[model samples]
Target: LAKTTQPISMDSYEGQEVNITCSHNNIATNDYITWYQQFPSQGPRFIIQGYKTKVTNEVASLFIPADRKSSTLSLPRVSLSDTAVYYCLVGEVGDMRFGAGTRLTVKP
Candidate 1:
């Protein structure tokens, strides 16, 4: 199992960019880093993913270093609606596991 680590919480204001980082010291060569956003009572929502370097989508951008030991999820111009728990999973598609996650609170 690929264990992950992340900040317990983060605070941001509306219209600001928020970057949350996750660390996985033992990430395997075939492992993929995927991020998810979840609201209070909702399931996790896929945001962005990357195996290495960087990957960007309409929602966010995921950046991974060449070493692949860590990754950052960057959310641009976030709003209050973006306030949620962000999860980082490491490993293959169906074998991925979630850490505690980073609770992001976007203030107006």
Candidate 2:
């Protein structure tokens, strides 16, 4: 996966919105940006993905700018249960690396 970086934590109250951003300037053309959500002691779950522009699913929305160097994951009306680690990975699913992820904190 293309290398990426994001904030270590974000504070949010219950019923509020949260947005996490990631940066991967070295991303390749064939690489796709994918975001994952992981609660403590659990594996990361696929949230959203996009090559460019915006892609929205039932869980979250992914927005990738035209440059493709950065992406954002937007969660609407978050709750305390939503507090979890969010990861941004770039590349195919099979091509992944083990790295430290950003730990998100949601407040109630």
Candidate 3:
């Protein structure tokens, strides 16, 4: 199993873009990769997910390098409402492991 590493926290202002990155070493070839966003006292919500190249949605974009050892979650034009803890997950369906997560504080 791979272990992931991420920053403890990050700060950004409203209307700014934020990028949170996670690094997973010794990742398996079949491991599923994804990102989640969690607000205080709330369960994590799916944000963006992918295992190769890049995947984009209305809310955010997920970028993975060719080696698949790391990924970055990019949030465009974030607002105060986007303040939350973002986690990077890797593994099989029922065995996914989440990183410590990056706490994003979107200030006004």
Candidate with maximal lDDT: 1
Residue-wise lDDT of candidate 2 within 1-103, one digit each (tens)?
4788888777888887788899999999989888888888988888888999999999899889999999999999987888888889988766755356677
Summarize candidate 3's per-residue lDDT along 1-108 as a digit string, tens digits.
Answer: 667788999999999999998998778998867889999999999987797999999999999999999999999999999999999988875676776789999998
Better of 1 and 2 by lDDT: 1
* Residue-level lDDT tens digits of model 1 in 1-108: 888999999999999999999999999998889899999989998888789999999999999999999999999999999999999999886677777799999999
Instruction: Give the clash count for each candidate.
Output: 0, 0, 0
C-alpha TM-score for every candidate: 0.95, 0.91, 0.94
Off by over 4 Å in 3: none
Which structure among the candidates has the greatest TM-score?
Answer: 1
Q: After superposition, how far is residue 39 of candidate 1 from its true place, in Å?
A: 0.6
Residue pair clashes in candidate 3? none
Query: Ten residues in a row with the worst lDDT in model 2?
Result: 92-101
Question: In model 1, which regions exceed 4 Å deviation?
Answer: none
2 versus 3: better lDDT goes to: 3
- Kindly provide the TM-score of model 1 when superposed on the true structure, using C-alpha atoms: 0.95
Off by over 4 Å in 2: none
For residue 98, model 2's alpha carbon misses the true position, in angstroms, by 4.4
Q: Please report, in order, the local distance difference test score of every candidate based on alpha carbons.
A: 0.93, 0.84, 0.89
